[model samples]
Target: MTAGNTGRKRPTISDVARRAGVTKGAVSRALNSGTGVSTGTRERIRLAAVELGWSPSYAARALNGKPLGTIGLVVRRSPEILDFDAFFPSFLSGIESVLSGEEHATVIRFVPDAQTEAATYERLFGDRFVDGFLVTDLRVDDERPAMLHRLGAPAVVVGAPEGSSDLPTITNDAEEAIRGLVRRFADAGHRRIAHVQGDRHMLHALQRRRHWEQAMGEFGLEPGPVEHGGYTIVGGAQATERILARSGDERPTAVFYGSDLMAIGGYSVLGEAGLAIPADVAVAGFDDIPLASFASPPMTTVRSKHRALGSAGARILLDMLKGQAPPLSTVLTGELCIRDSSGDPV
Candidate 1:
């Protein structure tokens, strides 16, 4: 006869310590920064915490006049973008991977415009809701690094190097990957290679476009028609339609999109136009997301380490919070994934 269990109280750090056969101080050191704890003991404490379903309370920390064990991430994008844009999900998962081990929480906020975005940051830091921030989507003439500095808020930028700011950055260098993609197309005898880029306001989008143009010039090929896709599937489709509007010899034989979502959208437009992928026109994209592999003919794209970028950025932020100086910049490499969509994966 088993009793029905209900109204059970939440587990605490004490329970975790008891379960792991360690003292509460050991639990604190293990979860906070592993300062005075051994690796084996830390792992044992973490497993105990997980088993006990115990996580530190940010509210409790705040009440105790301690730094909130919280990390802030404010994304300046429509909420709908989070649904289809694969980068955010993977990046966030990476951040969680590190933060969870440290018993920290992430505060995510979405804003529709720059004004609202800036205000959100101010409010979050000003109110002590978060100890630090993880900034993303580096823009042209970005003001976030300087703004955060003024507020004396610790932060780590998760994108390309910002010449105007000295904040630590975790970036994925995709220039060579983009160039390699272009070279692959050229080697496959593609002369007119077009590109569908994201918003020019974003540094990443601008960088991708630049890489494509430079790679085209390097191959002694005239760059094909270029269009802005806004990093959306619908935008990709519309851009593809415009690209196809060109006359016979001017039309591109291969198209490289700045994102997999755009390339997937381009797929639909190509299908409706009765064009066979890799048979009539080759296709490629950046960010080799899960769907890229499942794409009808599969997609050839650049695999940027979005998860690694997030995890690395989180680590740097944690180090900053601990009064440690992290490197000014950390760059991860991107890989060009060859798939069937790009002319027999050559």
Candidate 2:
């Protein structure tokens, strides 16, 4: 068996140098900075390193105050909640796409609350275990950007939060998209349209709520009941139950959910109540997750490019690592997908 195949110690720089037919100094230069090394020589050294399964030691780099070539992400949510959320996985895939090309890694921490999220960042930064961070799930008056700035930690905020001028931000034009969705509902003759809002603490959820209200006012219609769904299936079901309990004259003819999961939950409750979509209570949801299309009667929703958001944040962070300053803000726009759930023909 080859040295790499054997269950022995990992290959060292010297092994890489021997494999590449280069001096130890040349190997170090190629691995560290590639300065003073020809393109062909650097490629050979990199190939040797890969073939021999040699990678720079993180502990040694930490000791020398060198970059660990990893980005940190602290999400203020439980693992279960994360698993059900469609945006994170797609976003992470985008981040991996960029990091893989640079031979970097991502350190993700899923915390239950803000305190644990803060502590995770502190530990990662104190240990120099990451070169930078990608911050997501922004809140109103978020303190993370300021905290990271104080620590001199380079970070990219995945959502635009207030008082974040010191950091780069990647955001989506969700407000406009939500407005368009509401307008579409109005055009479809949804006069008594209600909204099942996600968590009010989250900026994106609040923005969507505001957009919905604004669109209603613009269309000369009164906003219907606004239920807090907590961005979960159970929450959606509970909220739908409340809506169903309303008197016929007070009931909404259509509902707009903040997330697809909630919409699915709403669908279950609607089905149990024997209500036909669009004919009785039309439905719409946000974050066009994979399951939305396959849902019975399909689902009308906003197709936000969550993966692109992740990729943009990662790209900005990588640029920061390379001593290049990226733009202060980047905004992605999404489209509204009209489906059968909203009374659109199949």
Give lDDT per model, in order.
Answer: 0.90, 0.89
Off by over 4 Å in 1: 1-57, 63-65, 344-346
Model 2 residue 182 lDDT score: 78
lDDT of 2: 0.89
Instruction: Please give the range of 10 consecutive residues that has the lowest summed lDDT in model 1.
Output: 1-10
Candidate 2 per-residue lDDT, tens place, 1-346, comes to 7755766888888899899999999998887766879999999999999899898898887898878889999989877766798789899999999989878999988888888888899999987888899999988888999999999999998876865478888888877777877787788888899999999899889888888899899989899999999999999999999999999789999999999999999999999999998789999999999999999989999998999988889999988887787899999987789898998432
Q: Please list the residue runs of candidate 2 whose C-alpha ends up more than 4 Å from where it truly belongs after superposition.
A: 1-9, 23-26, 34-36, 344-346
Candidate 1 structure quality by residue, lDDT tens digits, 172-240: 888898888888888888999999999879999998898899999998999898999999999999999
Cα misplacement distance, residue 266 of candidate 2 (Å): 0.8
